[model samples]
Target: MMWRRRHIFDPFYELKRMEEWMNDLMGEMQTAGGLLLPESTGKEVAPISRVPSIDLIDKGDTLVLRADVPGVDKSDISVNMKDDMIEISAERKGEEEVKEEGYIRRERHYAKYYRAVPLPASVDKDAITAKFENGVLEVTMPKVAAEEVKKIEVK
Candidate 1:
């Protein structure tokens, strides 16, 4: 006679899921303000010049890569294509001196940053255009036509 097996549903999975939820909730409360900040090494995070939190959208025949590069100078921003990625770099410096005293708390500091995003659609690198103003950098890379795409044959 062959032995029969029984399938048992594990109940601990629910407990694990609840554990994750509680951990996430606690982490958010810990970072609600500077009160939750970790000890710094006395070294500031070198701003990426212009690391744009971006939205890559497809608009017909073009891929619109919009990055949120606030407080970045238009002159300091640059867009370059590397292999299959688009790179944007910018640098911003804070005002040197504060005029009056009693400025107890000031946290709006600035630094340089660089951001790179991959283009989802095939883009016409030569036809791309970029605009920067109000501290926003927008780079438009036109999609390359299907007929324009080339594939390599592997040996």
Candidate 2:
């Protein structure tokens, strides 16, 4: 006679599995809605985009721009200023565990973000200074002095 071991189902294990499934679903929805939520080190939840929100301020002598770029490496960010336009770009890489787990419902947060702002006045591109700290980027650009207008009399 062949004897087969009978499998026993534990209610607690099933409930825990269900909870995990529900959490994964909610995470997907959050990511789809373009939500940027805080990340927990214990377990990476839904990977939200790392696109930095920005604020541009027009000061008397300099144009100050602040961007909220969290969870992004400093080396992945770039800023460019040309004439009266400023461009900002950044990228975030997805977690390796999420990629390895092909069946798990996770937000593939590998994302690239780009933004351009037009200055209200001309600025000195060479004199621009930018600083990044605590996931925030601040850029200061000096404004060019206005040229004096000389009226010419036409005969």
Candidate 3:
């Protein structure tokens, strides 16, 4: 006679295995630049949006913000200002073609950037100015005058 050992099912063990698998999958997705899926044409597509690096500085009377937006034309950038927030968005499109002896290769690249920043103080939107030069965008916003608080005497 042959003896057989029965296996026991543990729900917790299954859950732990699922968690580990999920973590690994997420790590790979990030390394591959977000989730990629194949289209009907057999081409891989991924999300093309990114956040541009920026520097915000407060100079007492004004707030200066500098954002890096390389490979983007000035006409492709847009800046919107509200009482307490500023929004920046830009897009870049490029194409490259190469022809070697018997093969022709072409590639297209696209990039989109968006960022919204909240101001710590009220700004004078009418006096705000922006400049885009050498792939860098600089925005200067004047701070609104603060009202003086009057102290009351108590007996």
Question: Which 10 successive residues of model 3 have the least lDDT summed?
Answer: 37-46
Candidate 1 structure, TM-score to reference: 0.56
Pick the winner on lDDT between candidates 2 and 3: 3
lDDT of 3: 0.85
- What does the lDDT come to for candidate 2? 0.75
Off by over 4 Å in 2: 1-51, 98-108
**RMSD each, Å:** 10.5, 17.0, 8.3
Ranking by lDDT: 3, 2, 1
Model 3, C-alpha of 51: deviation from truth (Å): 0.9
Per-residue error for 47 in candidate 3, Å, reads 1.9
Off by over 4 Å in 1: 1-51, 99-110, 148-155
Best by lDDT: 3
Clashing pairs in 1: 47-112, 47-113, 48-112, 48-113, 48-114, 49-90, 49-112, 49-113, 50-90, 50-113
Estimate, for each residue in 1-155, the C-alpha lDDT of model 3 and write its tens digit.
97544486778878999999999997788688864443422133347766777899999999999998888999999999966999998999999999999999999999887777898889999999999999999999999998889999998
Per-candidate Cα lDDT values, in order, are: 0.68, 0.75, 0.85
Candidate order, TM-score descending: 3, 2, 1
Candidate no. 3 TM-score? 0.67
Leading candidate by TM-score: 3
